[model samples]
Target: MSAAAGTGAKRPARRGIVLALALAALVVAVFVGANAHLVYVAVTSQPDCVPHAKEVGIDGAPLRAARSAC
Candidate 1:
């Protein structure tokens, strides 16, 4: 009687642990999938170099630049 009750209680606890693990795995899979898509885009996409400010001989000033891959 008591042993059966103890076993029954353990089943729900085990189920809860399994459910939590499955949820965690789902979240991890989604994150990895999205990052994988972003990496694929970055590797396969190319952009034309439009005209931009290429100022040089300036001290501590930032300038926009693009690769000459038109």
Candidate 2:
């Protein structure tokens, strides 16, 4: 009877651990899927950091600053 009680207690503990792990996996999957599109864009597309690549002294920061000044 004592051994049966020990086994029963362990079953719930083991189930709880498994449930926690499964929940964590689910959350991770959702987070990754949500960001997958942005990840693909960043990886596959070349970021237009420099607006005028040929023009000397032209930077994105200046353009962004000019736009925000409005």
Candidate 3:
């Protein structure tokens, strides 16, 4: 019947739209997850002020061995 044929065609279009939306959501989730990990590392990581063995008199050298509060 004509109605059955129209409904069948619309079903495929609706499925395609749903599939596209799911794929887009998956991409967005992956991107957000990666950025979240980077943010966490940046927040939780601490900087270390290591003394250079050879280059002692550098302009920005630390006066003493100390841990940075980065």
Candidate number of the best lDDT: 1
Error of 1 at 51 (Å): 3.7
Comparison by TM-score, 2 against 3, better one? 3
Model 3 lDDT at residue 18 = 100
Which candidate tops TM-score? 1
- Could you tell me which residue pairs clash in candidate 2? none
TM-score of 1: 0.74
| Residue pairs clashing, model 3 | none
State the displacement of the C-alpha of residue 45, model 1, in Å, after optimal TM-score superposition. Answer: 0.5
Q: How large is the C-alpha RMSD of every model relative to the true structure? A: 4.3, 7.8, 4.8
Locate the minimum summed-lDDT window of 10 residues in model 3: 61-70
lDDT (10s digit) by residue, model 3, range 1-70: 9999999999999999999999999999999999999999999987775545334456666453343433
Residue 11, candidate 2: alpha-carbon lDDT: 100
How many clashes in each candidate? Answer: 0, 0, 0
Residue range with the least summed lDDT across 10 consecutive positions in model 1: 52-61
Better candidate number, 1 or 3, judged by lDDT: 1
5 Cα displacement, candidate 3 (Å) = 0.2
Candidate 1 per-residue C-alpha lDDT over 1-70 given as tens digits, one digit per residue, 9 for 90 to 100: 9999999999999999999999999999999999999999999988766755556435544665544553
